[model samples]
Target chain A: MNRLDDDDDRPLSPEEMLRLIEEQQATTVRRLGGDPLLTHTPWGITWLAGFGALYLNYAYDLLSRSTALAVLFALMVLSMATTFFAQRTVSSQVRGEAADRGMMYGLSWMFGFACVVAICVRLSPLLPSEETGLLWSVTSMAIVSALYAAGGALWRVRTMFFLGAWLAALNVAGAIAGPTVHALLISVGAGGVFTAVGVVQWMRRRGGA
Target chain B: MTGPRELDPVIHAQARLRVVATLNTLGEANQITFPGLRELLGMTAGNLSVHLGKLEEAGYVEIVKTHRGRTPTTYVALTRQGRRAFEDYTATIRELLDLG
Candidate 1:
């Protein structure tokens, strides 16, 4: 967290420095909508890492090394973009009283998850087939989606909450019924949920001051 | 006109309140940036800088300055001593409030 070298030119005593850190921290919480959850980076980080690992596993087994590499490249690009976007939305104070960009951020992880899924589904037909690994792969994707959902809720992101709720439904249904139900979930359910959320966020942004 | 209320007196300072409470919640590095502090407090730069300077003078904060794109930025983090002081402050308040 401390990216700077210790300033030994230190005008303040060790005692004074501690005081400043405390004061700044209190202000930070207020900035984050006073949400208790945002203070803990590890909470965000755990899901972020978990999702990354799960996606890695899904992409790692690709039959064509080129495809895997391509997917990896996509991940890097999406991650950098997400970082840029999240920073822009979060750091900027809402222009008006009702403007909470937290809701808008749902599309962020949705975009992230979609990238991975699109790439994986694209590679599906290209793989060797004695072992389908279909059920486990679906389950894994479902779990990753659950994390995304839960994480979004924790972050006060309505978009993520919906994604999480839907993914949870998909996880349970898929576990019981297998890939027979995937097309419905991937197409109708996910599309419906993302569309509804995206519209709501846009409306809210327009409505805000 | 009897005794003080149960709320922690030490959290009286707003910026310190953010730092202590914020750090209290985390295990990994307890550090944040000027932008984060800005958002958390919703304060203008001058106002925060004033309070932060006071806290720095008090040894309650550790400021680390760095440059990006030729712009200098500051990172503020809580010290171990600061953490204990805040914990004690909170504990005393909790005891008074029977929150524990």
Candidate 2:
């Protein structure tokens, strides 16, 4: 550890002082958060494998509906757990208004999804099995897309904003294509997008972009 | 036009300057733990404490000692006055450099 000296009288050119200020600010911003890849990759994998299982189960009858749903549920749980732990690890080290904002943002996701689940539960019993599945998947995707877009806008992350827009469009397209095709579209389209975004973020970090 | 603008002495010191700059990165209502700030700045605890004292005296920083569970912790935040002073200091530096 460097001892702080009474460098108050130390002469620095204006350029040097400006550079020092910039450097300190940059370092603090970088150090305050966990890597984005930690959150993105787990979610990507969960959606890919979970939705892929659903597609196979629905299209080819390769798996039972119960088994497919179980796989999706388990993967979703795991992804949520990973995200929670990653956030907790980072938030524990920092405190303040930004942390509170982050906490509220995370809670919004839970609150939003709980509402989606409740709505789906009430509506599912009235529809046919296929429509019920479509309703649940579509509504969930819509909520997720909306949250992502909002979060992206809040944080000024362009890629996240665009990804959310893309997901919203993809969800609509899948719904239009009908039920079985909806699962297939989400399995390939949404899953692929998530994985691709995760990979791009990871590469950017590795390349120090 | 006139003689060069003077930077705030309270924020112009190298160590305190770095501290203020880092704290400024946080949101207006945010704070950093003493250990967190020290580790970020790579300063000795004694050195940081001394500098923080000086900044606190100048009303540039607010240091709050509180407990989290059974553990005691100190949090350091930049007061609004400190932020304004930093902004003024930067403006003066930029003017001196003729960077507008």
Choose the strongest candidate by DockQ.
Answer: 2
lDDT per residue, candidate 2, A29-81, as tens digits? 65665556667677777778887888888789999988888988998899888
Which numbered prediction scores highest in lDDT against the true structure?
Answer: 2
Q: Model 1 chain B: which ten-residue window has the lowest total lDDT?
A: B1-10
lDDT score of residue A188 within candidate 2 = 76
Instruction: Please give the clash total of every predicted structure, in order.
Output: 34, 0
| Each candidate's DockQ | 0.16, 0.59
TM-score on alpha carbons, each prediction: 0.47, 0.83
**Candidate maximizing TM-score:** 2
Please write out the lDDT profile of model 1 over residues A11-128, one tens digit for every residue: 4422344455555543433334322222222222333333334334444542343443354346546544555554555444332222234445545556656766776676667765
